[model samples]
Target: MSSIIKILPDHVINKIAAGEVVERPASVVKELIENAIDAGATEVFIDIEKAGTRLIRVTDNGSGMSKEDARTAFLRHATSKISDDADLEAIRTMGFRGEALSSIASVSHVRMLTATPGSSSGVMVEIEAGNVKSLADAGAPRGASFEISHLFYNTPARLKFLKSAATEFSHILAAVSRQAMAHPSIGFRLTHNKKPVLDLPLSMSVKERAFQLYGNEITENVMLFSGGRDNVHIHGLIGRPAYSRADRTYQDFYVNRRAVKNASLTHGLYSAYGDMLMRGRHPVGFIFIDIDPALVDVNVHPAKAEVLFRNQSQIHDLLRDVIREGLRAHGMPVISTPEATG
Candidate 1:
């Protein structure tokens, strides 16, 4: 009898890997945007059709790839972000795993046109279900444009798992908003089905970007804070005691400009409010933490949304202390009652 074990083909392996990275349309948007930013893009435009089930396009003015690089970018485990083991310890760019392009291409139709600066022409590569369908010369700017369509089209199970168009678009919007807030200097524009959702130009400060994305009502009610100790630095806006929320949806945390979720950090943030916050109420604010890359590990998770800090306790204490002092210095303003106003 023949051996029972068999090796899976590259196409099959790619589709299986897609399960981890390309969960939905929003996941595609996130990967593309992060890649654009990693390429030093100053302006990024995101356009979605039918809540990204039909089409998703990310155009950026960044360092585009050459013909050879563009063709090899879709290969699994191929990345320019890191070369050796030591580089992983100090990961700074948003993309490093090299699984994003391969995983995404396995589940959708992808058309990438890219050209580097000083190049007279660009290369356009069309792929479907992990197969390169076409490669030709295309006229394009000195950057890259990724056009993805029919997400999860080849995978019926994945298609069945998606939510409604409205619901999916909301998640995409939230993801884009977080990236925009994290990088205030980058210009971002979002359009859904030919309708404008958000358009923000390059902002000089986080406060200005917050006002543009969140509006005056929320930004006005928050106080800015900046402090740090040793090699760790923390800076962001913290809401007043009166400006509380029913949920933690309003809380955004970024470590080294990468969005992350940490239970200890979240608890520390809530504890800083102390008795000022009403029970079950959460504060609305954004916190950006900057620490030595060696002190944190971002490769713990496949999505890279969860990080492990080398000194969790010390960082938590620093965060709580800085926020507590910020609140004390910027005393909460009194809100007049209805009867008093009348």
Candidate 2:
């Protein structure tokens, strides 16, 4: 028996992970902005040109890092958020899975300038095609400013799959709007080719934030929910029967402040909606979940956009009950709309 396994290079592993995480400009936008949010940024600014194909620059007024931390942030699996299995179980922060920065750096030419408050200087690090080109001290403003130029430059195949500039830009804007809606206290702004597309100056409440992103139709139809059982709890907004979507794009889920996409949980919500939505339509809502972190695994997904729950059924039950109650509270017809009206 020959026991010999080849070890993959770090760059190769990161590139493969990038394939899962960086599906498009939209995914990049989501991951980077989420990092900013995790860093305690009260204000975030995003600038993109050529729909982020040529450039994607994110500037955040957050708790910026020291030079050492900024340099280490590009390393795979290096994170300050969680250290061990115990730390994983109670993830109070948005970015415990430190895969986003590594995956992105693998596929793009990244130049980052980061500074902490009261620091006389900042560190400027340049990475080209997964290789560090330079690291030097530079004069820069506080907080983190990342400039990703020639995105997917090393992977032309990925570039070919990208949509037109207008379409990609629209997708990026939609993602920014979604995050901004979730965090009302966080001021967010987006600029496309030096033109301002969105300017939200810190909303008063989640309801106000939702109204700013979505129209009054959605705001009025939204049903608020918050409940807890044992080690898990749920808090979110589910759309009333009147406000639904053609698909699940409008549905956003967060586990302990980290955005995730759990299809099983999504199904539970749909089941609760009943006949209010047809087979093809989906509901519009944000589902924020809180669970003992040990019971869920976020590392299974390269994008960190998904998780595995130990008691999926229990979580499903929780989601269904809340949604059902929300619907009932809104006075949804006891019978089908068509039948009741008939």
Candidate 3:
């Protein structure tokens, strides 16, 4: 038998990567939104049609890319975020892996138009299924715009696995909502089938953003709490014990401006509530954790939806105590258990 170990082609590799990053239409929204944020965008506009199965467009007024940069961005592992292994230790930008564009372009129809400030013209690149079809100068705005259509079109299997349009659209809304909460200063607008769903203008504070998203009802029901120790600060809106939800759908957590899901965070939150929290119900609030980037790992998750804290126990205890004390200060009765009091 002949030794048969053949290297996968670039397209095959790209499709494989797409499976990890572009799991669904919402995943595309998430990657593009993060890119816009990393580019220092102050405003991001998202439009989807037929729940993103037909079209998904994200426009951002951020530092646009150069013609060359635009071309290179679709190449796998081509990144401006990090240069060497040492840079990984202290990652700050939202996009570092450089796999998003290539991964996304590999699975859908992608067209990117980008131009820097003061530029008279912009560059447009059309790519389909990992193949660059066109690149040319065009008249455009001073930012970046990505239009992805027919998500997972090249992979029939993946496309077939997608949920109903309504379900997928909800996920897209949730994705945008998380990013909007993470960055209050950035204005976000979302439309589905050309109907406005969420229109949040630039907010000065998290409270203002909450108001924009949920109105005075949420602002009045939630309290603010902030505390830190040894460079780990935790701060955000915490719902009053009486104002919780039947599910965890309303809870939002961010670590270093990145939306994430961490068990330690959930545990710390529930622990702080102790028996004050009703059974089968979860708190409704936003939690923002600011820690030294070196102390937190962002590269562990494929989509960066989770992080690992070097001092997990310290963070847990700090979050728990801060919430508990804050609740106490607010005059809310917190029935602390022995474990919680200890």
Please list the residue runs of candidate 2 whose C-alpha ends up more than 4 Å from where it truly belongs after superposition. 1-5, 334-342
Question: Compared with the true structure, what per-residue lDDT tens digits does model 1 show for residues 191-225?
Answer: 99989999999999999999989999888888999
Candidate 3's C-alpha runs over 4 A off are 335-342
Off by over 4 Å in 1: 1-3, 332-342
Q: Give Cα distance to truth, residue 5, candidate 3, Å.
A: 1.5
Q: Candidate 1, overall lDDT?
A: 0.90
lDDT for each residue of candidate 3 in 78-174, tens digit (9 for 90 to 100): 8999999899988888889999999999999999999999998999999999788999999889899999996888899999999999999999999
Error of 1 at 129 (Å): 0.8
Question: Where does candidate 3 clash, by residue pair?
Answer: none
TM-scores for the candidates: 0.95, 0.89, 0.97
Error of 3 at 122 (Å): 0.6
lDDT of 3: 0.91
Instruction: Give residue 30's lDDT in candidate 3 (0 to 100).
Output: 97
Counting clashing residue pairs in each candidate, in order, gives 0, 2, 0
lDDT of 2 at 282: 82
Candidate 2, after superposition: displacement of residue 86 in Å? 3.0
Candidate 2 similarity to native, TM-score: 0.89
96-140 per-residue lDDT for model 2 (tens digits):
777888889999999998888999998899988778889889888
Q: How much RMSD separates candidate 2 from the native structure? A: 4.0
Model 2 worst lDDT window (10 residues):
333-342
